[model samples]
Target: MNTATASNFGVAASAGGPLLGDAEFQFLRDFVYRHCGIALSEQKRQLVQGRLLRRLRALGLKEFASYCELLRKDPAGELGELASAISTNVTSFFREMHHYDLLVEQLLPRWLEEKKGGGRLRIWSAGCATGEEPYALAMVLAEALERTGSKVDARILATDLSPQALEHACAGMYALDRMGGISDERRRRWFLRGEGRYEGYACVHQRLRELVAIQPLNLLHDWPMRGPFDAIFCRNVVIYFDKPTKQRLFDRYAGLLEPGGYLFLGHSESMHGLSDAFDLVGRTVYRKRVS
Candidate 1:
């Protein structure tokens, strides 16, 4: 009966389809917040409706109520698709170049030198949207290993909530246009250009695949791996989280990181006042306190 819900009903009725009633919207908002840790305001009602319309069409669903019912019935199986529909997975290779610059110039070298000779180094791309971030990471890590001739067992763990994104990440393929952020030398070094019917696409090299492990994960849920990860790249991800959710996630991240370990957030995200376990080390970067 609120203005936004009423306006939504009027719009949907004029378009001649089942509407997302107030009850259904409330249920959905609560469900997303509870399970996905994403707080959906009344304002996002229309955006959710607009994004979910494609899912409705794809699922051959005639009513938003049915979609809600489907969620109620199979929340875990469909959670990825729902999260994907609601959120934009805007990512690219080296999308934030400074983070990579820090890795290439500083972090990787330091980790390699410290962990040399049978040491294990783990870097996690926590919201690795379509393989770009992890592959970019692999490129640098591989170079560091080669440059140092180190025998460190270095690996990258790339995880995301979207099944579609995780699939793309596992495939490690991209259109040539998506290669723009990559330097020409890196393109030649790290990717194999496709041929014939596969033209205009390129796939990451095998060594990069060997360096990264792709898995589908919901960050709001339990993590399978117990890690003292050296660095975690969760860039541009927590902006959707509410304050409490951010606090819980940051605490969990602190629990999983080594002392003095690094966490890279999107340029816009800050850990200010959320957790005392870290110190702001650089632009949107936090380092776990040694204590």
Candidate 2:
């Protein structure tokens, strides 16, 4: 906690009530990092204070310390709410379009050719916030396979740490305005526009929904799926984690991917000084090395 954070919390306490003290912030920070591997910096103290204020109010707690005590008492129950508040779920359809371009133009074609004899094609959308990334991947993959006239079966496993986000993702509905990035052609092809009481919303087509399986997953914990994924979209996810956490995660991803499988990271993220299992293949993309 710095002077600025202390001042902010002091102001909030004087006016709005329930101050987040330095020790409280540290406890919450360590707790979140231990549970979810999200490293909150000192700069994020104000952010955590602001976000958790609502939780404190909801629980009718007057002090941040009391809230922390409650969290310790009911780890399983309160953790989800805390995660929902602290986690950033920003995402969009066809976000970072170049990755999709690469998938459509090069990776999918080569993968189809490699598995042509008879094998399954699988992609994982790790940290798949609100389902857009996985849905986008499903659309691109379906279109690519259709264009190439390949008959291989393909599926996407979309996972996230937040159960609330998973529920929303599973619903597969979005406001019509959120479809701005999607082309009219794709919107028509893949989403069912709402009508009557359901106006202003669009539901992902059953065809696309059928291809995705949404599940709640904390990336820090053990993953149940036995995957040798062909490609993985973990973009913009590990930016919240520290180096050692990122190293362990990248190592786990390396183990989960098939040889030569692609891993797509956020534009700002890299595997440099983290893991040697992957070699950079394109901008923010890496391919697993054969062992």
Model 2 lDDT, residue 276, Cα: 93
The best candidate in terms of lDDT: 1
Candidate 2 steric clashes: 0
The sequence of per-residue lDDT tens digits that candidate 1 reaches over residues 39-156 is: 8888888788878878888999998889999999999988999999988899889987988888889998998888875678999999898989999999999999999889899999
TM-score of each: 0.95, 0.92
Clashing pairs in 2: none
Summarize candidate 2's per-residue lDDT along 162-190 as a digit string, tens digits: 77788889999999988887999999999
Q: Looking at candidate 2, what is the lDDT of residue 134?
A: 94
Native-to-model Cα distance after best TM-score fit, residue 132 in candidate 1, in Å? 0.8
